[model samples]
Target: MKLTIERAALLKSLAHVQSVVERRTTIPILSNVKLEGRSGRLSLNATDMDLDIAETVPADISQPGATTAPAHTFYDIVRKLPEGSQVEIEFKPDDGQMTLRSGRSKFSLSCLPVEDFPVLSGGEFPFSFTLTSSELKALIDRTRFAISTEETRYYLNGIYLHAATGSDGAMLRAVATDGHRLARAEVTMPEGASGMPGIIIPRKTVAEVRKLIDETDGEITVSLSETKLKFAFADAELTSKLIDGTFPDYERVIPTDNDKVLDVDCKSFAQAVDRVSAISTEKSRAIKLSIERGTATLSASSPESGSAVEEIEATYDSTPLEIGFNSRYLLDILSQVEGETARFAMADAASPTVVREVADSSAIYVLMPMRV
Candidate 1:
C-alpha cells in the first residue's frame, strides 16, 4: 500500500483508532492496526476483540493494497513530524515492513499479515435510530457517573438504554446506578426507536462514543441488536459487544411518595458541602444536612480533624429533618443539576432521597443516606 496523506488528517484518524489497541496483548496481530489504501481513501481499523473502531480519511493513493502495522509507534512518528508536512506511506509485502516518510525523517514499522486481524462483525442491526450530538451528550453525561465499577454485578457496570412511556409521551431513557446512588435521564423518543430491546452498553463503550460526539454537531446513527451495538458519527464507526446480563428493575428503588421538598441554590449547597467535607475522614466522607423551615446547615466532623458547620439559605416548609450523606456522592449528583436551584424530596432521614433540577424534569437522581 502506498499513499500520501496530510499529517493533520492522518494524526486525527490515527488518534481515534489507536486507542482501541491494548498496550499489551497475547496475540501478535492484536497489537497492530489494519490499513487499507484504496479508492482515494485510507481506512484504519483497530480492535481489542470486544470493541472495534474503523475510520477513513482522504489520501493520495499511488498503489492500492492493505497491511498491518504497530498502532502506537506509527501514530507517534506522525505526531512528532513537522506541522503541515505531507506524510507518504509505503508497504512492501516482501520485506514485511511499512515505511513512513515526511520532511527529512523516515520510520519503518514491522508489519503483520492482514488476515490475522479479528473482525467484530455486527450481524443485522434491526433496531436503528438517530440522535443529535447535543441530545446524546446529555444522556451520557447525566448518568455515566453513577455507573457501577464493581465487577461482581456485571450488569450494573453500564448504562441501561431502553424506551419507556411517561405521562407526557414515549421517551428514551438512560439509567445507571452503583447501589448507593442512581441517575436517570431521558429525551423525546425518536421515530423508529419504539419497541427496541433494552441494552446495557459497557462503560468503556459509553466513554468512547461520548468522545466522538464532541467532534461533530451532526446527527449520530445508532444500530443495535441483542448482543452488539454500533455507533456511526462523523467519519468513524464504533462497534461493541453488549453486556450479557439482566439489569435490575430500577423503578423499584425510586421513591414516589416523598412529599417533603427542600430547594436550595445549587452553587451555595455544593460549596458548603465541599468546605465541610474537608474535616471529614477520608474513609467515611460523611456530611450532615440539617433542614428547617427556611434555613439549612451542613456539618462534618472527624475525630482527628475536629468539625465544621456552614449555614445556607433554603426553601423548606416541611418538618425539620437531619440527614447524613456521603459528601462525595452529594457533590456528584449536584454537578448534574443544570439549573440554579436543586430540589430534594425526602420522606425521612432513613429513606432514599430523590433530587432533581428545579426547571428540568428530564433527569432525576437518588441518593441513600449514611450514618454520620
Candidate 2:
C-alpha cells in the first residue's frame, strides 16, 4: 500500500487495531497488521482468530495496494515521529518490503502476503439496533467487574446481554456473576431491541469493545446473530464470536425475600471495607460486618497480620446480624453505586444479600456471604 497520512491520525488508528495482535503469536501473519490503501483512504486490520478490529482513517493515497507489516513495530515508528509530521508508506512488491519515510528518517520493514490475514465474519444479523455511546459504556462499566474468571464454568465468563421487562418498561439488561457475587444493570431499551437474542459475550471481546467505545455521545449501531456480534461506530468496526455456552438462570440467584435492611453511605462503606481488609489473610481476604442497633463494625483478623476494626453508622432496625464477605468483592459492588446511600437487604448471616441504591432502581447486586 502506498499512502501519505497524518501522523496523529495514523497513530490513533494503530492504537485501536494493534492491541488485538499478540506480541508473541505463533502465526507470522497474525503478528502483522494488514494495511490497505484505496480510494483516498487507508484501512488497518488486526485479529487474533477470535476477535477482529478494522479501522479506517483518511489518507492521501498515490497507489492502491495492500500488505501486512509488524503491528507494534510499525506503530512505534509512526508514534516516535515528530508531531504534525506526515508519514509516507509504500510496499515494494519486487523485494517484499514496506518502506516508511517521514522527514529525513527512512526505514524498511519485512512484510507478509496480505491474503494470509484472517477475517472474522459476522454472519447475517437478524436483530440490529442503535444505542448511544454513553448508554453502552455505562452498561459495560457497571457490570463488567463481576465477570467470572474461572475456566471450568465457561458460561459465566462474560456479560449476559439480553432484553428484559422492567418495572419501567422493556429494558436492555447486562448481568455478570462469578459464583461469589453477581451484578445486574439495565437501561431503557432502544428502538427495535426486544428481539435480540440473549448471548454470552466472551470476556475478551467485552474488554476490547469497551476500549473502542469512546466517551462521546454519538449513536452506535449494534448487530448480532446466533454466533457472532458486531459493533459499528465512527469509521471503526469490531466483530467478535460469542461464547458458546448457556448462561445459568441468574434470576434464581437474586434474593427476593430478604427483609433486614441496612442503609449506609456508599463511599464510607467502601472505605471501611478497604481499611479493615488490610489485616485480612491473603488467601481468604474476608472481612466481617457486625451490625447491631444503629451501628456497624467492620473487622478483620489474621494469624500473621494484626486485626483492624472500623465502625460506621448505619440504619438497621432488625436484630443484631453478623456477616462475612470478601473485601474485594464488597468494594467491587459498592463502587458501582453512585448514589449517596447503599441499601442492603439481608436475610441472615449465611444467605446472599441484595444491594441497591436507595434512589435508583435500575441496577441490583447480589453478594454471597463468607464464613467468618
TM-score of each: 0.98, 0.97
Supply the global lDDT for candidate 1: 0.94
Query: Local distance difference test, per candidate?
Result: 0.94, 0.92
> Which candidate leads the pack in lDDT?
1
Residue 79, model 1, lDDT: 88
Give candidate 2's error at residue 154 in angstroms: 1.6
* Per-residue alpha-carbon lDDT of candidate 2 for residues 1-372, written as tens digits (9 for 90 to 100): 688999999999999999988888788999999999999889999999888999999999999999999999999999899999999999978899999999999999999988888879546988889988888988898899999999999999999999999999899999999999999999999887887889999998888889878624588898999889898988889898899999999999998999899999999899899988999999999999999989999999999998999999999999999999999999999998999999999999999999999999989999999999
Report how far residue 238 has shifted in candidate 1, in Å.
0.6
lDDT of model number 2: 0.92
lDDT of 1 by residue, 305-328 (tens): 999999999999999999999999
Instruction: Please give the RMSD of candidate 2 to the true structure.
Output: 1.3
Off by over 4 Å in 1: none
> What is the lDDT, from 0 to 100, of the residue 150 in candidate 1?
99
| Model 2 stretches astray by more than 4 angstroms | none
